[model samples]
Target chain A: MLAASGKLDRRELCRALLADRGDLLVVAGLGAPAWDITAVGDRAENFPLWGGMGGAAMIGLGLALAQPARRVLVITGDGEMLMGLGALATIAVQRPANLSIVVQDNEHYGETGMQETHTRHGVDLAGMAKAAGFPRTMLVTRPEEVPALRAAIHAGEGPLFAVAKVDPSTLPLVLPPREGAYLQARLREAVLGPAAHHQL
Target chain B: MDRQVMESRPAAADWPDGLYELLKTHRIRQVAVVPDAGHARLIRRCLADNGMRVVSLTTEEEGIALLQGAWLGGDKGVLLMQSSGVGNCVNMLSLAITHRTPMPMIVTMRGDFGEFNPAQVPMGSATQAVLEAMGALVRRADRPEDVVPTADATIRLAFNTFRPTATLIGQRVIGAKTFGKD
Candidate 1:
């Protein structure tokens, strides 16, 4: 069980959630979530969005729907998720069993100087996802809860949505490959094997 | 809601079927759409195809990201939307432009050539210019016969050359929405 401080350590939580991930495709949102995933050791299977705010979940949906046999995890921020809230409804309707979305809810726009976001004022992302009909929804505010959350993500019987409440302290920047094309190609090769090279 | 307009339109042309066949031939297995009357037939065809996955989005911008992800996962997809939806997709389109992601979009035009809704005019008239400004190649299919060829060209430009392309299916091709018929 984690401390009852009500705020989990972001880095520790990310590492736990992604620990021993095998064949899991990760799409990280811009800003802190991107840094968090890269901090976990960037790999060809991890495609971090340098920009394209609000797109992480939908991108995961596409990849999940395309590669149904593999699990797709999208790690994004509350502010980014709020921008594309409609995606929850869409994802629910499509209901890709292999998709999991985790919102690192520090409750602020970390990219734009930590201005407080709606989550700070009681916006419930997990509740919204539940209302949108996600099969699994969780709100994590403690370290102990992370193992269960990680289990749910790896379970692969979702359309799952989880919000991890984390301390808002700014962390050191951990950047991934800056070039979008290179990242896309690398992820493609990783997912499709040798066939990606033959694509025009 | 727009089924009445779709049903009342002129005898369906062969182009919608042609466009569908072309997409399948190119191995497009995913379709992201924001429902519009002009694309009714195409949407129906996609939904019926066992080999294709049709996803209905709340907004058009989601389609851009969805298609990019599909390509990343070694699949091809098409975005189906109306002209008004283009306004919602402007910034997200940058994902395609910046990443040089191949995107093929079929846009059904409104607010031109016998439009009933005054609200759709501004975005409709500016659609081509806005797409061009965002570095997307824009082509128009005004007549039934032009649909397949324009879509073919769009596919070539998008997948072969790694550019975003939009095929504008004019109101002239899909038939303008009729009003005052409750």
Candidate 2:
């Protein structure tokens, strides 16, 4: 009995959030979030996870810590976030200012035939993140809040945690590079330029 | 933070220092760890080193993704954990295996030599075999002097050969954890 209060269209929100992205590295969680990111536009910097479900946020943390000069965003689903909730504590401890985690909370496990997730009941991911010591945390329900959330992500003074409640309607699949090696090489080449060739 | 290596006790041995130097030589900037006494010295050294980005993970499985992301970003990283933590990483090891991402893990073993805790025995005994089963090249360092060479081979295997490699720091090198001590 989840309320249908989410007014923001996920694809539009993703498009708006990533419209001005320039050299920003994105790690998309498995299933829906990956499609959301891909729907916006696929690039060498956008790493959409096909298998690593709960590992997106930590991967974002690693990328953020490694490339301090660049902005790192982790766009994931509520189910995925819940599975890797401990990552919030770890990310809070590291406090990499370049990192931002955005959860597309559709209140359902969309990939597995749209079953209700914990967020549909009473799970508060943003609250959990704030309790875990993230400096900035937000819950965006309305489309108007998207701008502020985008600003926070680009502000570069974060360990920001945001959960955007989106419609539970499923969208068409948008697949990125299926080969892990290709995705890895594309990202490396984009980040390190000619120096990537020298690495293993 | 100051770069001084924290513990100065001679009894602590130089194996941790040897491994630290090897990591530095390989330009490993990211260190993902779940704390354990056996890895304390190495963890502290990485934390104090200004050039290294030390990520304290809640679980060892997180290290797999972190290191994969590090490699994706054109940087190198290592996972420091105890043998017990190896059990936590089995499933996530597929991320490295399927992706063909190079991962170097430094594990301090338990339940092998003078182990007082029976809880650590099961996982400790299964650690090397588990890592090997997950397609990681496993090596062991039984003595203080063997640390550097084992780490060297592991690094070469991981980074150069594009394969996941692990070096198990033997109980003899790290010393057994006493029950009624501190």
Candidate 3:
């Protein structure tokens, strides 16, 4: 399926972004981004979506807004990001200092038969994000740039947006949990403590 | 109903203020809106209140996903949109329903009684059906007095039971819009 894979390995990129994660909240888009994050480690702070296709960025926005002090990062594929392109404008307007979005741009939909997405046709997601008013926007194609990307996610003053051109080759699926209720409960309890369910 | 009576009188509307009180009581920290005139009063009240974070969404579906994140981060929230915006939320609602996310949506009706626009008829009339099909429990609040109580029940079903619930306020309660100058 990939016409040609990008230079960066997605798993390696995720590992770098999540390494030594300290109270960092992550929202992964459905498909590759979700698997990539899970591939790193299936921790509770990682809210890997199994189905919500176009909502990864907005989820990060809500989490960032709700917990203003905590860092929020969203990892999503290009197709996922394209479908919700308006979210970039939305996130830009909100300009949450704690939120950062990393789009693993493979230029193809890695799942669903590896179809070529808009990015393959020369569409620039990073440019669009920059135009949408993201304070910091980066397009990463080299291995060396990942450290800066990781550092930005951990300590950058955002709302920041980054697009990393990752390898389009399909990888093993590392799903966190299929049941939505279970994942939701785990994340809530992990972030809010054991009494999360009893709060209402 | 007489033509002059329908044209002349501004309806007594307390539901917006009443709804605001209930949201505060629920401690809804995040309030998302895809602005609509029907929700103007409630949005105004929410904006004035210092306790909540009112987010202006580009689309109704954003609110759906936003509420999920809010709940995941230990905060309660709601979405306010118009009947037409319900169509935009169908796909996103799947994640909300499966997650059993407590989403209390307050949707003001558009295409039903006294509707002026042809564009709104399709989605507005089908709003209830669409939500129910998506696994969101739908309730209507037609009368002025019934709006608050219905909203309360919808909120309860959402948070206490972790079901996606919608309180669809009718055009009558929201007041009808017309093309001609009043």
Candidate 4:
């Protein structure tokens, strides 16, 4: 059953998704903790953020279509999504069964300077996701409501979107020069098993 | 290099037909492009044509990234750009080689081939060597007549072989000046 969470948002949603099997998550654009999961945890993180925004969504869509059996989640930001709005239509038309797009709408580019964006420009993200042919969607703005959203995500179907409206200023202070070794050990154990360590 | 082959080749007005042939015959549905005047006639035409989805990009490297993604997504794609932008894409080309993305492109020559601008020369001179260094198959289309078949052949070979192929078009092939006026 589809559900919503009030206290939690997409960052945690990404962590949860990463913890689970059956999905390959691509952290596109920037400002989120996806690399922390993939890089630190030693998962496959393609399409590194070099320059520009909005390219990753298209990348994620492409991966999903290519690997249809494997579930794919693209974690995109509001500003990045707005930069390549047409990609949404392309995603909608292709409608890959394994694709799930989760946009953390902080209403700004949190990584850069938290500048205002199209969402703040009064663009409706949920509406846009729907128009982009995502039959199942959710918009969560409150805290204490993320767990149920996690459940909805785990149980959801093709081309779903969970738009988590967030306050970027309140986010936890992330420690960087990241915990690559520790996270990789933990994640490798989780996904590939303890014996698989020697191979990588 | 065949003059008869060059003369018999169709013109820009025939691009839609050419593109249609490219899409249908080659079955290339995904295209990654960096904007440039050298190939603007074909690129603009392709963008408007519904035959394939044009993935417009901010940088030439991003074009390679998109092509990589498209390949991962099960679509054969091409990167279109002018010669100068080749330098911007070199690093990404490494990513392609490391991952074996089998990236292919249609590069229009701007600096060389009797280039007037000083800025266009460096990359134009470097184009073939740079591509060769990346382990890519570089084919130069020095004449208008060679473009269509060369593009067609490049697209086919790149996809089939899982290798990157580039077509460098001389100014004469794609028109030295823009459409409408001098």
Candidate 5:
């Protein structure tokens, strides 16, 4: 019903973010909100795992520090975030302005059978991010709030953090059994765009 | 013990000295570290410097995933950890094998050179076999002089070949007392 209502704006929010820049996109762990964006767009790359939620964000930190001019987006899950909470302190110290971490909070490891997560207990991810030294953190529970979220993200150079509270909509489960080749191939094209494949 | 004598304390490798230059020359800007005694100096060098970033992980397997992200995100990076930690990294190594992500890491090996702790021997013996099984190339360093050249060559091999390479620095080189103090 929420998907039909167009009320959840997560798909569009992710679409806008993916389309906005030629930066790095790291899809770590599972239960990400950008699953649809990753499905449709020719850009964005994801890691395969039911664990390691904050893993993408840490990788994004590395990428951002490695190349400060390029933007980096991390699509993380609430459950995965719990596993690597310490990485947040590491991010705070690095403080890369080109990095933006988006936590798609659905309150569960949705892909791994809708297991309970910290978000289920009204855990404030934004507050957590701010406390971790991501000064520009925002929380949006509705889809319409995404535009402002996007604006804030682009305008605010970070080490910034944003949490988009999304409703659980049944999305395709991707990991082993289904090859990530398709996603990698499309994202490769999106980044290189007919150029020769070169190691970075 | 004289004040002037202590103050002079004959110079060492200048803290972050050749490390940043080495990483920059190789264009290695990201690092994944699983802490160990042998490579702690190099690992701490990466962490203390502002020029490069280190991603610390609970297990070494996560370093492979981090490397995948680093490669995809447009940064050439390396994993820094100890030899025994390789046992924890098998599944992630399989993922690297399947994905063909070229990762370069300096594994500070313990338990083989002198053999104090029996616990370190099993994984130390298993490290090379595990790496080979995962299709990763392994190299060892036994002296400080070998450190720079081996690192340079391994980094080159990893980037040029687009496959993982291990630089195993034995305790004989990084020193035994470096891990613990009395």
Candidate 6:
């Protein structure tokens, strides 16, 4: 659907951001973003929403609020972010310093026949987030700027928002565990230690 | 944890106050909510307490995912909203069903049993059934005195069993909204 493709490969960008991720809790939006996170390798700290469409950012907000000491990151596609744009305002009001949101703007809904999303029509998500009171917002289109975005996620005062323009190439699907209950328990055990592992 | 402001009084225990105390006793720290007139008293009471963090939402679905995240971080939470907000939460409730997230929702009724507006009827009547269809256990507290006890039970049911539960405070308890003439 896009005539001029973005230079950055989404898989490489996700791999770069997750490298050396220490105590960072990740929430990946459903669809391509979830696949991207899973491709990098699944960790207990990583929560990929297998179905829920508009919840990644708010989930990051809640986790950040509950654990201020740890960093929280949400990686979502443009279509997913647009679906839950109101969450940015709610998250801004709370201003959880540990939270960061990154939107992979491919301008097309990759899972759904590459339908053109709002981002394709110059809908600026970074601008909206900046207006919503996020202290730091970035629009990264060049390859060199990826490091800054990663640094902001790993070690920066946030709730930061970033939208990375990525190439809309159809890639192989990398799925996480399909069972939500198992994934939920896995995360609790990781974050809360062995004690959180309770019988159903 | 400022329990003194919200508590330190057993004499004048209304249902809202009792419910507030119940949340504190249950160790619920995150109050994921969408504001509603029926729940004003308890919402204000929660905001007043230093121990509770009332995270307001633009819509009700955010609360479900927010609570799911809270559980990941080892903190418990509760969702407070009105009956109509339940419609907004249908798709999002799947996270709780599939993940078995422990979520307790305290909903104040708007359209049931003497509602003024006809617009409130559809979702209000559908609230319990919708939640049940989504695999969330449902209960109702139609009397003022029963609100706290039912809420407490539902909270235990949710956390202990890792199931999503909703406790509906009936419109009769809220004394259905009236226009200027009435």
Count of steric clashes across candidates, in order? 0, 0, 0, 10, 2, 0
Which portions of model 2 miss their true places by more than 4 Å?
Answer: A1-6, B1-13
- lDDT per model, in order? 0.89, 0.88, 0.88, 0.63, 0.66, 0.89
- Per-residue error for A7 in candidate 1, Å, reads 1.3
TM-score of 6: 0.94
Model no. 4, DockQ: 0.19
Off by over 4 Å in 5: A1-13, A16-34, A44-54, A172-200, B1-25, B32-37, B40-66, B84-91, B115-126, B143-149, B178-182
Task: Give the lowest summed-lDDT range of ten residues in model 3 chain B.
Answer: B4-13
Candidate 3 pairs with clashing backbones: none
Model 1 lDDT per residue over A1-200, tens place: 23245578787888998899999999999998889999989999999998778888999988998899999999999999999999999999999999999999988998888899999999899999999999899988877788899999989999999999988888899999999888988999899888886855
> Docking category for candidate 3?
medium
A46-95: candidate 5 lDDT, tens digit per residue = 44343334465665665566556556667677776776676676677667
Q: Tens digit of lDDT per residue, candidate 2, span A79-196?
A: 9999888899999999999999999898999989898999999999999999999999999988778889989999999999999988888878888878887788788889999788
Off by over 4 Å in 6: A1-6, A198-200, B1-13
C-alpha lDDT of residue B107 in model 2? 92
Model 1 lDDT tens row, B1-182? 49865763442376777878988999999999999988888899999999999999999999999998898888889999999999898888888977788999999999967888899999999999999998999999898777888989998889988878999999988877878652
Better of 1 and 2 by lDDT: 1
Candidate 2 C-alpha error for residue B97, in Å: 2.1
Candidate 2 matches the true fold with a TM-score of 0.92
- Interface DockQ per candidate: 0.66, 0.61, 0.67, 0.19, 0.27, 0.62
Interface RMSD of each: 0.9, 1.1, 1.0, 7.5, 3.5, 1.4
Worst 10 residues of 6 chain A by lDDT: A1-10
TM-score quality measure for candidate 5: 0.75
Query: Which of the two candidates, 5 or 6, achieves a greater TM-score against the reference?
Result: 6
lDDT of 1 at B105: 94
My TM-score estimates for the predictions, one after another, are 0.94, 0.92, 0.94, 0.59, 0.75, 0.94
